[model samples]
Target: EEEKEGLDKEEEAAKSGAADGSGEDGGGGKQEVLDKAKGLNWKTGNPKELKATAAALIEFCKEHNLDIPDDAKQARMNVGRLVLSMKGSSALEIVEEAIKKYGIVAAKAAKAEQREAAAEAMCGHPGNAQLLLAFQELAQLYFKEGNRNAG
Candidate 1:
């Protein structure tokens, strides 16, 4: 298909861009790193691959003069812990265990006050703040419903 050919062309360009060191701000390398992350075998719970991907992401952020977001840092820590404690479990089992141990969804739901505070901090007027909070909650709901780009 034309779309596949277009993608192949873009991939070729990205590869050549890296070889020639012509990508702006190492964009080609960043794309390659992201591709590696996307290629991860998550179903098998390969801790080594997870750790390597995490480390690569951290290093990439550093090298690009970008701050590691809190969520990314937390993910790296989670990967580290998982790597250390894994005993040949599938990623699904690992995730189920994590959900039970950390109550991840419950914790998110319990942070309503924090969201309210943050919304208020970003918007001084109380009515606007409440509106912002409502929008935020709506966006979160959409995201949970599998519309990742809802926000």
Candidate 2:
């Protein structure tokens, strides 16, 4: 009975996490943003107001110094691009603000690939070199995945 209770507790926690959209990628905030975006009545609201909301969210993230993960950044960028493409300059400005605030972190994460490659070049031990090469490959894969997802 104790084991069953523990399992039930674990399942409940998993369900809550999923409901909150805090999956393995740690994109709870991004999910919330997407939800809010979906909930907005774009046709009824003034376009400027929508843009202002996006801008405010960007500022909020900056003021909080939120450390967005790579996947979330990519998701946000993709959403921004979509909004910009659909809504013109105002939406683009919001996206630009988001990029300005979060772009550096995302770029640094991508550059980890280069750093791993450099480490691989510097290492002398054959086993270490092999491991570093594997790491470098993994980093490159992540960078490419992020780039693709961002677009």
Per residue, candidate 2 scores C-alpha lDDT tens digits across 1-151 of 4433543454453444422223344343443343333433332145565555545544544543334444656645644444555453343344333433343343334334444444555666534755755664676577668864433
Residues 42-88, model 1: lDDT tens digits = 43246566676446434544443232334866757864565446545
lDDT of model 1 at position 115: 49
Model 2 RMSD vs true structure: 12.9
Clashes of each: 0, 0
Clashing pairs in 2: none
RMSD of 1: 15.4
Overall local distance difference test of candidate 2: 0.45
Residue 104 C-alpha lDDT in model 2: 32
